[model samples]
Target: MVLDLLVVNPNSSRSMSDEIARSVAAVDAFRAFAFKTTYMTGPEGAPPQIDGEETSHQSCDACLPLLKDPESEYFYKRYDGILIGCFSDHPLVEALTCLTDAPPVVGLLNSSLSFVSLFPSGPSSVITSNKEWVEILDASVEKKFLTGEARARGLWKGTVSSNLQVLELHSEENFGKIVERIRRENVERLGSKYVILGCAGFSGLQYKLKKIFPEVIFVDPIILGFQTLLSSATFLKCQNV
Candidate 1:
């Protein structure tokens, strides 16, 4: 009853991949489930952060080759599931899912939005790094998780004005100032109870942000993606039994 999971960060930066792994591994759920988590960064040519459709496409292209590597292929064969750690819902999710029949592929964006909906509150907003991502994430939220028949219902009430770049999230010179502004604008002003971290680089931010603003819920998409991948794997295993 062991769970083996692989989280592939669709960026060339190993540091970003390490951050995602560190955040997920620290969770109590990892200990409770007897999980073995492994991580891999994207191909060398992938961008540090996927800002828009073009960069997202580049990430997908770089990811496929990395997944095909011997080390990754080994994990692909043995791991219970794979989670794409980018918040963009990169095309690699579909590509990896098509690789196998048993192991399901989950993306951070899809799982996080789905997780946000579970909260029994209205007017939740997403706090992302770049302004360029505002519309991209909004569309993803509508089309992937909120669409029903011909209509679309977006769960996010608004997005905060954080003009930071995704790659600089962890080490930006004005990190503290930006966080305060996000809390002030998105939480206090906009009446948003929950805020989704809209970039993968924002992994592990909840632990710090929650201490200051305990009343507000900060959703980390990477952790949610890990949980969703593990749950899906367990469910699929049960189905086989």
Candidate 2:
């Protein structure tokens, strides 16, 4: 039987979900596996976008019930691993972890942080949607990825924001602004060698950004999360076999 992975976007925006699917499809096309995917979005009660602590809390309350429901299709056992598609260190990732029966769960932030570490001379930074995420994620990376030695190494720089809402990223006109932010803030101001795309809406724009900044590496955390979760899912399947 083919293994299945579930991706949950903890917001009500279908456009964001579709963007994620498109990016995943691009990655999937190049590398097909005995794996399938199910993309889910936050229910009507959830906000259209997660901007800060309040929206994040609302998302948790709205989506958590569906995830925890034994009768729902999203109940954890159905999939081998679960990817919380939000680009932050979402509350859902930790909430799901509390369940003993839940499969391996990974978030985009967690996966991207880990990936950036592999390139030690990184001077890496995250370019996210809003100012709130800059504060939240900068502290998160420090607590998690930037430890004693890594802290001294300066492998991970910090996070910067474009001050744009997540859904706005879909606009064709806004792409230029995003590139400019990465150029002005992440690359030049911070001298970031590796720039991590820190929002789910920022998916698929990596190619465009790469062309603009040929020297700087633009890391799409969405793709990284999928690869990370799928690897765990595959390993678990093999263990059972």
Tell me the tens digit of each residue's lDDT in model 2 across 1-241: 9969888888999999999888667654334348879988999899999998789888988998998888999877687899998887689988999988889999898898788777877588989998888888888888776656557886677888987999998799898888888888899888899999999899999998888899988888888889999888776665565
Residue-level lDDT for 36 in candidate 1: 77
Instruction: Tell me how many clashing residue pairs each candidate has.
Output: 0, 0
lDDT of 2: 0.85
What are the models' TM-scores? 0.76, 0.84
Residue pairs with colliding backbones in model 1 are none
What would the per-residue lDDT of candidate 1 be over residues 1-241, giving only the tens digit for each residue?
Answer: 9898878999999999999998777554443455678877876989877888899899888778767565765356677888888887688888777775537888887787677667654557888877888788778766676534213343467566478887778885767966787778888787777888877888888888888888888899888888888887766665555
Worst 10 residues of 1 by lDDT: 146-155
What are the clashing pairs of model 2? none
